[model samples]
Structures are given as structure tokens and as C-alpha cells.
Target: MESDLLIPLIWTVVFGILLTLGVRKFTKKQPTNKRWVRPKSTDEINKSQDE
Candidate 1:
């Protein structure tokens, strides 16, 4: 009875740690200026110029 509960409790802790690390690794920000890559079309540029 105690072994059954202990097994799941240990697995839960291991899974929680893995989940935390996986999210930290996968959701990390890349070093880049994202705004500079998006070029405006001529029409869009002209519209902004008119404002």
C-alpha cells in the first residue's frame, strides 16, 4: 500500500521538474531585433508619410 503511493509521488515530482525545464528551454527568447525584419510596402510607407 505504501509502495503504491510512494511510486506515484516520486513520479509526480520527476514529471513536474521535467515540465518546468522543458518550458524554460523551449520558450526561451532568441536574440534578434524582430521589428527590423518586417519591411513596409511602398503604399504602407506612403500612408505613414502622409500622416
Candidate 2:
């Protein structure tokens, strides 16, 4: 009984930590400028594809 509860509690903590780290890793901005890349609108994408 205790073992069952303990196993899940441990797993929850571990998964929570991993999830937090993953979110932080992706959310961490590296810095960028228009020279590297820029966002394109849907219309631009459609126009480019048509050409």
C-alpha cells in the first residue's frame, strides 16, 4: 500500500521537474534580428507558393 503511493509520488515529482525544465529550455530566448530571419504572413506564404 505504502509502496504504491510512494512510487506515484516520486514519479510525479520527477515528471514535474522534467516538464518545468523542458518549458524553460524552449522559452529561453537566445536573441535575434531581422538579418537572421523574419516572420512571414499567410498571404506571403500563399503568394510565394503560387509563384
Q: Pick the candidate with the highest TM-score.
A: 2
Model 1, 1-51: lDDT tens digits are: 699899999999999999999999999999786575677899999999999
Shift in Å, residue 32, candidate 1:
7.1
Clashing pairs in 2: none
- Residue 19 of model 1, lDDT score: 100
Clashes of each: 0, 0
* Full-model lDDT for every candidate: 0.93, 0.93
Pairs clashing within candidate 1: none
lDDT of 2 at 23: 100
Model 2 C-alpha lDDT per residue in residues 1-51, reported as the tens digit of each score: 699899999999999999999999999998766485678989999999999
Q: Which lDDT value does model 2 have at 22?
A: 100
